[model samples]
Target chain A: MTAVAAFAWSVLQDALHRKVFYAILAFSLLLMLLIPMLPSASVGVQVDLLREAALGLTSIMAFLLAVIMASTIIPGELGRRTLYNTLSRPVRRWQYYLGKFIGIMAVVAIALLVSLVVLLILVGAKFGTFNPGLAKAIFTIFLEAMVLASVAMLASVYLSPLVCILLAGLFYVACHVKGDFLYRAMTDSTNHALLRGLSGFLYYILPNLERMNINETIAHSERVFRVGAGELVLLSAIALVFSAIFIALGAYLFERRDL
Target chain B: MEAVLSVEELHKAYRTRLGGPRRQALSGLSFTVPRNSVVGLLGPNGAGKTTTLKCVMGLVRPDAGKVSLFGRDGDAVEARRRVGFLPEQPYFDLYLTPRKLLHYYGRLSGMGASSARSRISYLLNLVGMEDDADLTMDKFSKGMLQRIGLAQALLAEPELLILDEPSSGLDPLGKLEMRDVLKSLGTGGTTILLSSHQLSEIEEICDRVIIIHRGREVASGRLDELLEEKGDCEVLLAEPAPGATSGLPSSASWAEDSGGKRLTVSREELSAALTALIESGASIAEVRSRRLSLEEFFVRRIGKTGWEVEE
Candidate 1:
């Protein structure tokens, strides 16, 4: 556990020094600050639009931070030969993998929290109301980012960062669209048997990432339906299960990989 | 002697990119480092020295065979707890100061914060980086990084130290200091398995050497035993004598240096050569069996063909 924490701390320190990390964070913050510049709408609808846009920006920031950090940390360490020093110690490979993943999430969480605070302040000053409900959307964004990070990190074990990023992007798109496209393709009698079978397998296997996106609902003050505690717990469970599977598989592959 | 580390029948092959043929990195390589012994792992480029070290360190998985550390399975984290390693050209995140980096590694090695703090200070001084300990490593030279690498490897006060090219990238003075440090550690009973291309450094510090070629062991043993050339004797004169070779046998060859005149002859001709020297009025200083230098021994073992091919 000490080794794991140390590795996690090292990743945090490493990420703090990376220009890309700050670049992404700064860019997201800059966009959020510019939210007031959007064309003026009615007083009520304008605030909702601002909240929605701000939450969307926060999600993108959190996801980008998680995926980029996860995708680059391992390969960068390997390329720099720093893994030789760290892994040569009395630490297990799984501990290192878990620590790095946790570190990536920690960074993403910090980024999300900062965005949440900024969004709250912006809404309070601009519209005279603190929509603290935005926290729900940010929390879900974090959960979804956890899944994306795990997937990116798993691919990072065998693929370059560019390839890993591209693959994770494709995975994100597929998981979000699978609920509609895949379900239709699976039941369409016009499709071939093998294609339908694959679609069915994918539809069942891949988590419905779209379900995790409550940004619009929360941003609009949950006018349609409240995101209950039960739903949050279920979302947490799904995210945890998928992240565990990807991370476990990644650790297994990393164990047998040559440094 | 009890062995601190042992590898048996280790084999590793790396697949070429794009599904090309596999390149054998280690082929049934085997050796043991006895407790408190400093053994040099010497090999040419692509001779699997690094791969063998990585296998023992658990950084690389062997295709077949076993590595045991402290008489336990090498894969066990406990087995590596007593070991420290400095890989060739050790690297670290440049943003970390030496103190921070060592603290991090010290934690990884299971050292408490307070103990690690003191140990870090001691090591920074020992490696002559105390003044620069707080500075980020980005500005550090390769030699400085190597020093920090050694410091981290020693942070745990490990029973065994495995170093790959420990003196790599160091200036002449740095190399000498590193040699002295390693020599002291060896004398203090820290077992070390050092892999290096610097034969001179190995000769100066290692008590024994294991030379490998083409992923196989060519020769290995104590330095004196391996370098000893049987059936050969060298006689040294007390002073330079141009006339020393006047009555020497045709098989005897003599060279002059600041020390004196030195003659090398086959064991069969030693008596005749000494008699000739005595009759020629040469003052004898010493007479002993001739021993090859480490470089000569390595060349002989690895062969000229191996040399040309590596080049």
Candidate 2:
């Protein structure tokens, strides 16, 4: 096999040696259990509940997985001095970082898909309808999770794991309402062109969580889904570009560091 | 033998907790190890031996100067394929047995699945770990872990082998066995570079020695040549009369001996003393000059301050 393929396999195998897979299983069970315990007054409230629950489940699990995984990758390798062993191989420093990125992303994707499947089954049992749109929304959640994971990895590579976890968690929470923060600033009458441009800068910097979110639309049929294929494609490209840049930065810092 | 590994003017440093500038760990250190030779890197604690190895492996980039392997520049990925490093206190997953661990590392070295599978058993046997190959690495003792680590380093059949404190936690017999093993590996045309504080251990296996203290290489060369250059050697008397002890050279004063027959002495008076003793009625069963062990010779050169350098 090629070096890149071998590196990817190594990263995946190392990750599995930890109980990362088991923890994901436990969380999936929790999500399944929550399906029958919905506190809803009416059918509309119930579907809204399921939609919120499913989206929240996928989002929360993805967030936790990324934070947990990214928090450990660099620090654990350094702590064990395994980073030295791995880097001593013929693989490039960038390949080491990118392989880790891909491995963690693959695990997150699997967890997201599995959680979506379980939630869909519950939804099918309760309402006699399995919403394909929910499945689609879960896919977007995985995409957003990839963005969040990249951000987390970038922070972890530069800062202590604690600081990385806090910063990444804060961004994950704040980005969910990033659109509202920008809109509030944009509509304020007091703002001039310069302030508006700065606000716009901040807006574009934080991921537009609203664009990728198809959760609320699935619940309220009147809310038109405005996302186009072009937007999804663009957003994915943006996430990937950001991730690559972040990973490059990580590799550069790691290269300069004395294990 | 060509210099398979050369470190020139290397430097590194760490920042203190109290907002300070970089504190240099390595200070213009330089040396060369001939190919296919087992060289001992000797130093006390905090002597920068580990730092040197890390720099050579590119785990820690030097702030200044260069480290080269196989004529290529340091930190070059291409150079790494020919190198294998066993860090101090190597930790694999506690859950992985030697069988699994070797296979895992082989794959990382870019071997195919079938190849890795085939090489696993072979590497395990090479380390004398064939019996415990099926046991978890964590369950094995420190000596076993080190042996398995050796296997991993050798899995790629590297041209240059760098090991740091490889026998730090072995029993006397284990150490002896390990030295023999390393000697055998050296014979196979793999240049081995290792660091340790055990003077006897290094003396036993190394063809050459490099002594580093506080990040600077104080001495390095062929073992016998280093002793000669540094003014440390022993005088072995044949069957000199008991009264001859009083006639010993001042510099050649009696030193801590092995058996009653073995005695250490200074370099200057060794020839004259041996000639005079032979001329006398002392029946020369065996008369030979003894060089100081690598440890004592290293200590004599460094003056025993224990790796302290000012700036």
lDDT of 2: 0.75
Question: lDDT (0-100) at residue B264 of candidate 1?
Answer: 88
Worst 10 residues of 1 chain B by lDDT: B302-311
Best by TM-score: 1
How high is the TM-score of chain A in model 1? 0.98
Q: For model 2, what share of native contacts is present?
A: 0.77
Top-DockQ candidate index? 1
Q: Provide the overall lDDT of each model, using Cα atoms, as 2-decimal numbers.
A: 0.91, 0.75
Which ranges in model 1 have alpha carbons more than 4 Å from their true place? B304-311
The clash tally of candidate 1 reads 0
Score residue A139 of candidate 1 by CA lDDT.
Answer: 92
Worst 10 residues of 1 chain A by lDDT: A6-15
lDDT of 1 by residue, A77-154 (tens): 999999999999999999999999998998898888888898999999998997878888999999999999999999
lDDT of 2 at B184: 87
Tens digits of per-residue lDDT, candidate 2, B26-74, equal 8899999899899999877777898899889877888898999999987
* Model 2 segments more than 4 A misplaced: A14-17, A186-201, A219-223, A226-228, B229-240, B245-252, B261-280, B304-311
